[model samples]
Target: MRYLPLSPTEREDMLTRMGLAEIDDLFADAADKLLKAPLDLPRHKSELEVERALGALAAKNLAAGAVPFFLGAGAYKHHVPASVDHLIQRSEFLTSYTPYQPEISQGTLQVLFEFQTQVARLTGMDVANASMYDGSTAAAEAVLMAHRVTRRRNALLSGGLHPHYAETARTLSEMANDDIRILPPDPLAQEDLIAQLDDSLSCVVVQSPDVYGHLRDLRPLADACRAKGVLLVAVVTEILSLGLIESPGAQGADIVVAEGQSIGNGLNFGGPYLGLFATREKYVRQMPGRLCGQTLDSQGRRGFVLTLSTREQHIRREKATSNICTNSGLCALAFSIHLSLLGEKGLRELALVNHANAVALAEAIETIPGVKLLNQSFFNEFCVELPGPAAEFVERAAARNLLAGVPASRLSPRAGLDNLLLVASSELNTDADRATLVAALREEAAR
Candidate 1:
């Protein structure tokens, strides 16, 4: 049966008592933004009708694998091993909730403990949390953490940082009344982050193989940030790049946050992804999210427990390090399981394969007339300057059954980057995919 908490009379009486004439009066502040009419969706339908309608809508989408896919700006399409899915589905691993009681929740705690260890080792940081909502939120939390640690109110974001990530940090900072300066888009990776650092800045967030797929050397920026007493928050949208490039921590980053989706996670239509957050040992107190620690029982049996949970739910609202109540536990487990399956050597080899594929694709793209390769160095993704608007090229490619890459204009419409396209090549992509993309681009450019 349908449940109604209040009748029309009760709601009207409450509104009247509050000096509101109607329900809409309560939203007076946002009256301008209120919708004038209900949505165009069907009001109601039978179960079978709803299912058929949804199925029809779903069929309209072209499956990623059905075409020569190359789309990646933040979320990527990588091959997740079948075992990773098989193991994460086990009843114990699948049904576990928050580890409120370590004795009863040892299994969950241990998984988080191992996950933390793996993230720390992967990012070359002294420590890591269980996980965050996603990379964008993790980046925002890093900014907040920097504010707490440095007692500064300003953050400088690199132009190469993903627009979504920068906007996430900006939104949080606005609420905290902190200052966030976002540089203009740097498709060429020409922004000198060091020159923008100042004493008022709490941190400088930079991304390697940034949104434009141009790799950045964080060491110089890290050194400059240190000299200025500012923290270096490095964002990694493509975590696999760490396998081949220097880790943010090793490059002197004070905090490293990444989108762990590329590892052991599918695109899943852009979500339920993992966020990897890591930082130096000295700054553990200021770190956000859950931290798991290893310990021993009375009988000296090794165990794991929640070492730190600073969200408001666990502590006083004012004292909480973050308001993020939970971690991506299941996704973290999948990441750990996949990483375990692919030891160090395996990950490095996988990264090499991605790079090789990207190199070949880039070479093929450069051969196309009027198509210009943008990056001098990249891991698995790069941008190309097309002869026409990138959006148009993408549309043309789509008509030909080629899933072209993301366009810069789609990310930042007013940035005058309409001619630039961001293409990502992964292990899932093949020589056939590369040839298809090249042929599509060649045909479109010739037009």
Candidate 2:
């Protein structure tokens, strides 16, 4: 018999307390629309039959290892050391949760503290928190934090920001009823946004090596924001680019939010990615999430401790900077270990490889007919203006057993961007993968 911790009587009593007749009442509207019939699923089979069925189904998946994937926008495919996965899977880290109860979570807390340090160093910021859900959420959270810091609710988001990241921020701001001004996506939106800045605006968020993979010159933008007393938010989805380019903090970015996945974390089907958020030391208290600090025990043994507990959900219901709970422990740990393994020199070298691979791919793809490389300046990813609808072209390529790039229309429907395609390449993509994508594009062009 299947085991349920809640007995039927107890469940009924709990529902009674809530003044609900049955659990279906929780989904009353859904219940009203319930399929008047059972789902037409396949018939159940014996355990052995099920195992055989699943094995055959699993055989159909074209895994990253089996294919030369050139897919990346936020998440990327990079070389992860065997040791990184080995250490994260260990029972000790997997079993742990929030390090609030430090006595029992020292190992977990120390690792988080180290991870924070890694993020701060990589982003060139004064401090960083344990971690956030992923780059997208982190980018969203950073917007709210900016609003609080400036005591202004209006935010100006550049069109060049990652479409997913921008859309997420807009949604979160809507829920918060925060006024956000979204700019048009300009692959070459080099206009100084600071000129439009004013006392009413809370912050200006811009991404370098933006969604199109173009490297932005943020120093001027940062300077413009400073003139208006506006906060400059720098968002980086491609963290590896930092190793190869100038750090945003070195410019005038008051807050630097980036996805930490490209460094040590793997793209596990969109996520479980790490968010890297950092800023000047003065803003540490106002920063979101838990922060780990170095402290000394009675005997002066160096130890890590939770620095600020003002976060909502941490204290009485009324007081909290945020309601976010439980950091991405395993993902952050993987990120920390990988960065540790690839220290400064190694990270820069790996970045060089990624950029080189991308450069090589771009050079080769440009040679194909009916294909125009749109962005003159980009890193790992760039837009390709195809001769036909990008979605159809991508599907055609997939039919040839090749997974083409993402269609622009997918980001924003009929964006009149149907012909634009965003493709990416990392160190893992071989020369053969480039040839395949180009060949498929040529065939589609002919058709």
Highest-scoring model, TM-score: 1
Stretches off by above 4 angstroms in model 1 are: 1-54, 310-312
What lDDT tens digits, residue by residue, belong to model 1 across residues 140-208? 999999999999989999999999999999999999899999999999999888887889999999999
Model 2 C-alpha RMSD to native: 5.7
Per residue, candidate 2 scores C-alpha lDDT tens digits across 78-191 of: 889999989998888877667767777789888988888888888888899988888888888888988888888999998788888889999999998999988876655565
Off by over 4 Å in 2: 1-60, 190-192
Please report the candidate that would top lDDT against the real structure.
Answer: 1
How many pairs of residues collide in each model?
Answer: 0, 3
Minimum summed lDDT over a 10-residue window in model 1 is located at: 308-317
**Model 2 steric clash pairs:** 311-320, 312-320, 312-321
Clashing pairs in 1: none
